[model samples]
Target: MEEPGPVHCLLFAEVTPPLIDSHCHLDAAEFDADRAAVAAAAVAAGLATIVIPAIERANFGAVASVCREFPGCVPAYGIHPMYVDRAEPADLDALRATLAREPAVAVGEIGLDRFVEPRDDGRQAFYFVEQLKIARDLGLPVILHVRRAIDPILKQLRRIGVAGGIAHAFNGSRQQADEFIKLGFVLGFGGAMTYPRAARIRELAATLPLEAIVLETDAPDIPPAWRVGARNAPDQLPRIAAELAALRNLPVADIITATTSNVCRALPRLAH
Candidate 1:
């Protein structure tokens, strides 16, 4: 009778599975009010790692701070093409100083963008070439932000002779993809593939070799189908991974393992 009087029920907690968000921008102003919460949400949603790429010289500190604050967040530094006009000559020197001081996992968010007309292609080229040199000298891989400038970017990469990097948000022809793979780069797929209208991209994802593919969400930016027009986050990676899995005709677990392994190999610094 005493035991029956003290009977209690315990609730079972649902465990979330873990995944890597290989690319994201946790330092952006969009997350200022709730950065800690946002990061926690990502972790709660099973994002085990995040790679935050620096967009300008000014954001390097913030990017580094976010990495330090989060256990699995890694930082990469470079000048984004759209911000080329705002970049100062000394910014490159500043970048070099910062690189020497902080030592990021890669050099990036750097590359050309021909989509915006009247943009100074020369300025973009100068900064890109310099960053590539920095990456080469440091023996670090890069996170490329190429758009409508893949041909020229490829030319520069070939000229620099540095091996491997991630072609983030890749949307190019099969031939172009092959060229990047030949340079040891891995093609990154993201929410774009989840769109029904993105037939070519989905086809590319399916045709690309499993070993050369990586998954990303480009968080706070490229939200997947269900999240279109909403703020994207690292938590969306699982959904994106499922899209990639479907495209490649593989199971979700296999896609996760292959893409995570490919990311680790491409970005050795993230291994820590």
Candidate 2:
């Protein structure tokens, strides 16, 4: 039998030394078996911080626990659009209560998703609008999960007039991007750009102003090219940073600094 090909490395040799994963889901069951090890690996790999956004009311406790356990992990709370069908009416109230009691850095993993079929557009919009109110009330930034529903999301945000937040794993038009930026939101980029076919996203990343961009892994989901078939972790941030730098024609350190600062500015609680 032929020997297997040598394993490929993802990171660039002279790129940024440290990078932050502005959004990730470290509380998921995939890491339950060895979450600590995974986190340690990420820290060792130069991942400065990992922001884990809560999916629903059910996982808020787990998300909070992970944040408490991990020194550099920050947690945000919100109901995801894909799971809108599962959210109870009281869940929104619970989210507000949780935000008041818990020490979350933001309100998020919330937004619209028109990609789902037999669409529950009404339900998604209701929850999204409610959470936007919650974020506004609490004076917290929001992390949006917009997918095929940028227009509606933008409209709601404009109407609500919250300060700012992050458009996680942003995949939208340059015009949409500018609107979000104008609203003081930061655009998050992740493994999607690593794909050879995502020319548009790559171009957006290349052209967007550095200050408006934030880095994220969206780990165990949007893995970079080197870890395509495997699970993703915050540790892969260095590689992602390098890719963004290559796209933007800037030094890795510059990308790292800009993204880190942007993340802190976008999510003030992370400053601690």
Candidate 3:
């Protein structure tokens, strides 16, 4: 008899292989209580890797430390838009200097966020454009944090070109999705797709070419529907991938294979 593959997906009867949580914050305080155990459990849950991106100057060291502490975690460095208000010019210098020293898989968890009130569009644009340039200059892929600012984020990505990367938790239109693809980027779909009410996201996941899609947990955020209103983690990635597989009417194995490939292509350094 053929050996049964790993069974991590609740609804995806198709066997699964090791998965990659393309975006997660394993360094977040939510896991500080038992971060090591969480990392071990995620590996046991069938997750082979987790990409952790730093949100600000403060956590740069912490993110890097997490990577050293856990073989399964990789790091990305950048300034998140939500933190630009408290950021200083010197921080950009710090980011550049840090990237010089660290082996980051990408430069990110960075981009525009129109969702916040009292929006400082100029400051946001400045930090975003600058960070994009740093990523470009470093020849590193970027992990974008695009919210209601997709078009604007796309515009800047076009202006300040960098190696292709993942558009984390992408919730844009199919047209926008195509635009990202044209630029050699992959769309990340996660916990949001698990919600039946997220019709638009479901439709995109169902219809987009699998080559253009990647899996992510956006952990400690974007909790899946089954685990709604609860803390999300890297271990939730398999079920999250299963949701996408179900959305596309494909087997979990196919989703796992294609998405894992997509992520490696998006962030080449992570492939190793």
Candidate 4:
């Protein structure tokens, strides 16, 4: 009986469930020096999966290579809007062929970006529409990189509907959030939501139905408040999850479970 007392403690030991970094540029140049260590750290930090998206046709090989090195890492192949200037029409064909040849989860890091200066609206539209068509034809979801262009993104989505995907680093209004969710998309919330001044984003994170929200780091990009101006990584996700839990006034475990399920539902291939 005396020894039996300590055994009960084992049953109650706190265990954190695995998390998914829905979007992370682990293959980006920022990680070139320590990619292997970063991947290992993510696993040790309890990351079950990390989705790495390609920004252009040239990097498709890089993305695939990263995924090959890290089994837990998955790839989403697409030409990002920012890089569309350098993209040739033939790259679209390459994108199509690559998606067919590779185990790509989605056509992404794709969408509009009005924030950039001296951009060709027509060029962005051309690439966006073509990529949307590719996603539609391939019957794959897309990972959107929307910036001041959610409405246009929604318009095209309505026109050439594809399988639902995640709106990475979503900073749209509640109405926009509803629209994406209605279209079978889950909005990604990450480092931006952790900031006190990101009120609109924080409000959305707290108020949006848990099922419509997914977690992402957008690593080497949107670093959390504590790590602002530093290189972000997938290992920061658990803390991001905790921030979401605090925002929603729910337990961290609940946030993790709901967001993980949301991601799987958004990208069904990841469930495998």
Name the candidate that leads on TM-score.
4
Model 3 / residue 99 / CA error / Å:
1.1
- Candidate with top lDDT is 4
Per-residue lDDT of model 1, residues 12-32, tens digit only? 112233466767998999889
Off by over 4 Å in 2: 1-18
lDDT of 3: 0.86
lDDT values for all models: 0.82, 0.86, 0.86, 0.89
- Note each model's CA RMSD in angstroms: 10.2, 9.4, 6.9, 8.8
**Per-residue lDDT tens digits of candidate 3, residues 163-200?**
98999999999999999999999999999998889999
Assess candidate 4 and give its TM-score to the true structure: 0.94
**Model 1 lDDT-worst window of ten:** 3-12
How would you order the candidates by lDDT, starting with the best?
4, 3, 2, 1
Specify the poorest-scoring 10-residue window by lDDT in model 3: 4-13
What lDDT does model 1 reach? 0.82
Among all windows of 10 consecutive residues in model 4, the one with the lowest summed lDDT is: 3-12
TM-score of each: 0.91, 0.92, 0.93, 0.94
- TM-score comparison, 2 vs 4, better candidate: 4
Query: How well is each residue in 1-272 modelled by candidate 4, as lDDT tens digits?
Result: 11111111111112356588889999999999999888888877778888889999999999999988888888889999999999999999999888877777889989999899989999999999999999999889999999999999999999999999999999999999999999999999999999999999999999999999999999999999999899999999999999999999999999998887788888877763
